[model samples]
Target: MKLSILDQAPISSNQSPREALQESLKLAQAGENLGYTRYWIAEHHDLPGLACSAPEVMLGYIGSNTKKIRIGSGAVLLPHYKPYKVAEVYNMLATLFPNRIDVGIGRAPGGSAEATNALSDNFLQQVWNMPNSVQDLLYFLDNDIPTEHHHARVSASPIPLIPPIPWLLGTSKKSAILAAEKGLAYAFGQFMSDQDGGAIIKQYKDHFKPRKHNESPQVIVTVTAICAETSEKADEIALSSLVWGLQRKRGEETHGVPDIQDAKDYLRNEKDGLLDDMKKGMIIGNPQEVKKAFLTLQDQYNADEIMIVTITHSPLDKIQSYRLIAEEILK
Candidate 1:
C-alpha cells in the first residue's frame, strides 16, 4: 500500500500559527525523505488552529523545499475560487514541478458560515453550480472543449508539458458519481464523514467511466492515524484530535490544539458519541497496531493509495508518526 500525507498545519499547544506553517514544510521534507508518495495540504479559513488557508501558496513553498514528493492541496475548496483561475494557477505549478503535482478539488468551504459568506458573493448559488464548476475545471485543465461549444475558443492557460494530476475529494456516492462522470481521480475523506468509505469506493469503481482526458480510475482514502511507542502514548496524542472534534461539535473553533491532559480534562466529565465518531475516521495505537489497522483499512476500502493525516500536539511526534507508518505499513 502507498502512503501519502494530508497536513492541516494544525497549531498545537505552545505553538504559533507561523510555527505550524513552518512545520508543514518540515513535515513535507520528512515525508519525502521517509518515502511517502505525496504530501498534500488542507485549506481551512477563519480557523485559529489551522494555519494554512491558501494551499496553492503553500504548495509552491513546499514544492521548493522538497525534491521528489508530490505536493498539493488535500482539497482546495473549489467553490470559493474560479475554475479558470484554479486551472491556471495549478497549470503553472505543474510547469514548475513537472510530474510532482496533484490537484485535488473539494466542495467543502473549509471554513465556517461567516467565512464562507466572505469567500463568495452567492454561496448558495455556487453550491448549486458545483457540478458545472467541476466540469469547467476539468475542461480547462485539459484545455479541451467540444468544437461546437460556445466557449471552445477560450483556454485557461500556461498549459504545462505535464498537467497537474486532477483528483476529486468526495465522501459520498454523489461525489463518486461526479468523479466518474468527469473521469477524474477520486479521494474519499473518511475522516470528514461517518459514511462507509468502502461502499463509496465500491460505487466509484462500479460506475467509473473512461475519459480521454485521463488514464485509468484512481481512488485514494484519506484518514487520520496517530502512532507512538506505546498504545497509551498514542491514545494520549490522539486526545488532541479528540478535543478538536469536540470543539467543532460545539460550534466553537479551538484556539491551538491543546495538550493531552487538557483534552482529557475537557472530555473527562462529558461522555458522548464523539469518540465513536472520531474512531470512524482515525486509528490510534503503537506502530504494529497502527500498521494492522491501516492494512485492514486498505483491504476494506480497496484504495490505490492511503493518505494519512497525523496532527499530533508535538511536531516531532507528528513527523515520527508519518515515519513509523512509512517504515512499517507502507514498506
Candidate 2:
C-alpha cells in the first residue's frame, strides 16, 4: 500500500512557527527517503494553534527540499478563494514540479464563520457555489472554454503540459457521491467518524463513472496514527495530542501544543462524553498494533492508499513516531 503524511502544523508552546515549519520539512525529507508517496499540509485560518493557514506556500517550501515525494494541500478550502486564482496557483506549482503535485479540494470552511467572512465577503454564497467553483477550476486547468465569454480568463504560464491529479476530500456521504459523479479520486477523513470506511469506499466505487480525466475510482483513507515501541507509550502520547481537539470542542483557544501535564489536567475537568467521542475515531498504539489495525481497514475497504496524521506534544516525538511506523511497521 502507498503511504502519505498530512500535517495540521500543530503549534507547541516551546516551538515557534519557523521551527515547526523547519521540522515539517525535515519530516517530509525523511518520509521521502522512507518511501512515502506524498506529504500534504492542511489549511486552517485564524487558529492560533495552527500555523498552516497557507498550504500552497508551505507546499512550495516542501517541494524545494524534497526531490521525489509529491507535495500538495490535503485540501484547500475552495469556498474561500476564487476559482481562477486557485487554478493559477496550483497550475504554477504543477509546472514547477511536473507530475509531482496533487490538488485536493474540500468544501468545509476550515475555520469560524467570522474568519471565513473576513477572508471572503460572500462566505455563504461561496459555500453554495462550491460545485461550480470546482467545475471552473477543472476547466481552467484543462484549458477548456470559459463558462462566460464576458468573464476574465486565466491561464497558466508554460501551460501545464500534463494534468495534475485532482482529489475530493470529504468526511461525509455527500462528498463521496459528488466525487464519484464528477469522476474524481476520493479521500475519506477517518479521523472524523467511526463509520465504516469500507462502506464509504464501496459507495464511491459503485457509483463512480469514468470520465476522460479519471478512468477508475481511487480511494484514500486517512487516520490518526501514533506509533512507538510499546502500546502504553503510544497511548500516552496520543492522549496528550487528543486533548487539543477536546479543547477546541469546548470553545477554548489554546496557542500552542500542551505539555503532558497540562493535557492531563484538561482532560480531568472535561466531560467524559467529549472524551469518549474523541477516542472513537483515533488509532494509537505500538508498531505492531498500529500495523494490525491499519491492515484491517485496508482489507475491509480495499484501500488504494493509507494516509497517516501523527500528533504529539513535541516535534521530535512526532517525527520519531512516524519513523518508527515507517521502519518497523509499514516496511
Candidate 3:
C-alpha cells in the first residue's frame, strides 16, 4: 500500500501562522525522507488554526525544499478561480519542479460565506458550472483549447515539457461521477466525509472514461489519523484537535490548538457522546495498531494511496506520528 500526507499547516495556541508554515516545510521534508509517495497541503481561508490559503505559493516553497515526494494542493477550491489562471499557476510550478506537480481541483468554497464572497463573485454559479470549468482547466493544462472556443486564441503559458497532473478532490458521489466523466484522478476526502466512501469510489471507477492523460481510474483516500509510541499518547494528542473542533462548532473564539491540559479540562464536563463523535472520525493508536487500521482502510476503499492528515498541539508530536506510521508501513 502507498502512503502520503495531507497537511493543513495547523497552528498551535502558542504559535503563529508563520511558525505553522515553517512546520509545514519541516513535515514535507520529513515526509519525503520517510518515503511518503506525496505531500499535499490544504487550502483554507480565514480559518483560525489553519495557515495555508494559497497552496500554489506554498507548493513552490515546498518543492524547493524537497527532492522527490510529490507536492500539491489537497484541494485548490477551483470555483473561486478562473480555469486558465489556475492552469498558468500550476504550469509554472510544473516548469519549475517538472514531474512533481499535482493540481487537486475542488469545488467547495473552503472558507466562510463572507470569505467565499470576497474570493469570488457568484461562487454558487461557478460550482454549478464545475463540469465545464474542469474541462476548460484540463484543456488549458494541455494547451488544447478547442479552436472555435473564445479563449482558444490564448494559452496558459510558460508550459512545462511535461504538464502538471490534475486530480478531482471531493467527499461525495456527485464528485465521483464528475471525475469519472472527466477521466481525471479522484481523491476522496474520507477524513471529512460521512458518506459511503467505498461506494463512492466504486462509482468513480465503474463510470470512468479514459482520457489522454489518464487512461485508467485512479483513487486516493485521505483520512485523519494519529500514531504514537503508545495508544495513550496518541489519544492525548488527538484530544487537542477534538477540543478545538468542539469549540469551533460552538462558535467559541479559539486561541489556536489548545495545550493537552487545556483540552482535558475543557472536555471533562462534556458528554461522552460528543467526544465519541469526534473520536470516530480519527484513527488514534500506537504504531502497530495504526498500521493495521491503515491497511484495512486501504483494502476497504481499494485505494491507490492512503493520505493521512494529523494535527496536534505539539509540532514534534505531529512529525513523530508520521514517522512512526512510516516506519511501520513504508518498511
Candidate 4:
C-alpha cells in the first residue's frame, strides 16, 4: 500500500498565496522524506482560495525540490490546452527528471465561464471533442500516427527516454469506461463525489486494456483526510476544509481556508445536509483511526494507490497530518 499527496495549494484567509505556495513546496519535500510515492498539484482557476492555476509550472519547481516523490499535475484540464503544447512541456519535465512525472488529464473547466473563456475560445466545443484531444495527446506522446492520419507530420519534440504516465481523472463509471477504451490509467476523485466508488473501480478494472505503460489495470483513489492525535482535535482541524467544500458548493467566492470559528459560524446557518454531504468521502480521525478508515476504502477499491488531499487553516497542521500518517500508517 502506497500513499501519495494531491496538494491544491490551499490558502487560508489569514495568509497570502505566496505563503501558501511556499508551504506547498515545503510540504512536497516533507512528503518525499516521509516515503510518499507521488506528489501531484491540482490546477484550479478563478478560485482565489485555490492558488494553483498552472500545475505544469509548479511541477518544475516541485520536481526540483523533491527527491523521489513523483511530481506532476493532479490534473491538467485537457479541453483548454493544445495537446501538442501539453506534450512538449511535460516531455521537457520528463527529460529533467526521468521516471518521475505523471500527466493526469481532467474534463472539468476548473473555473467559471469567464475564466474558461480566458483560457481558450469555444471551451465547451473543445470539451465536447475531449475524446479526440486525448487520442491526439497519446499519439503525440508515443509518436504514433495512424495511416492517412491528419497529424502525420506533427510530433512531440525531444521525446525523453521515460515518458510521463497518462492518468485520466473522473468520478463515474462512464469515465472509467472511457479510460478503459483509451488504454489509460484511471484516478477516481472520491473526494469530489459523495458516493461509494467501488463499482466504478470494478468496472474500470474489468474493462481495462493493456498498454505499454500499464500492462495491468491501474487505479488510484483520491479522498480527503485530516489526521491528528485525537478525534475531536482532528475534527477541529478539519473544520476549515469542511467549510471550504461547502462554500465551493454554495457558489460563494472563497478567499482562503477559514478557521474553526468560521467553520462553526458557517455550519450554524447552512442546511442540515451540507456537512453530511461534505463528509461522504472524507476520513477524519486520529492517527490510528485514520489508518483504519483509509484501509476500508483501500480494501473496497482494491486500489494500487490511495491519494490523500488534506486542507487546513494552518500549514503546521497540514504538514503534521501527513507526518503522522507517514509515521503511523504509510511506513
For model 3, what is the error of residue 109's alpha carbon versus the real structure, in angstroms, after optimal superposition?
0.6
Query: In candidate 2, how many Å is residue 141 off?
Result: 1.6
lDDT of 3 by residue, 279-325 (tens): 88889999999988888888999899999999899989999999999
lDDT of 1 at 47: 81
lDDT per residue as tens, model 4, 198-225? 9999999899887665388889999889
Single out the weakest 10-residue window by summed lDDT for candidate 3: 210-219
* Model 2 per-residue lDDT tens digits across residues 16-44: 98888888888899889888888889999
TM-score of 4: 0.94
For model 2, the superposed segments whose C-alpha errors exceed 4 Å read: 146-154, 194-196, 268-277
lDDT of each: 0.86, 0.82, 0.93, 0.89
Pairs of residues clashing in candidate 2 = 11-257, 12-257
How do all models score by TM-score? Answer: 0.94, 0.93, 0.98, 0.94
Sequence-dependent TM-score of model 2: 0.93
Predicted structure with the largest lDDT when compared to the true one = 3
Model 3 superposed RMSD (Cα): 1.0
Q: Candidate 4 has which clashing residue pairs, if any?
A: 12-257
Mind giving the per-residue lDDT tens digits that candidate 1 earns over 14-102?
88888889999999999999999899998999887888989999999988878999998888888888898999999999988999989
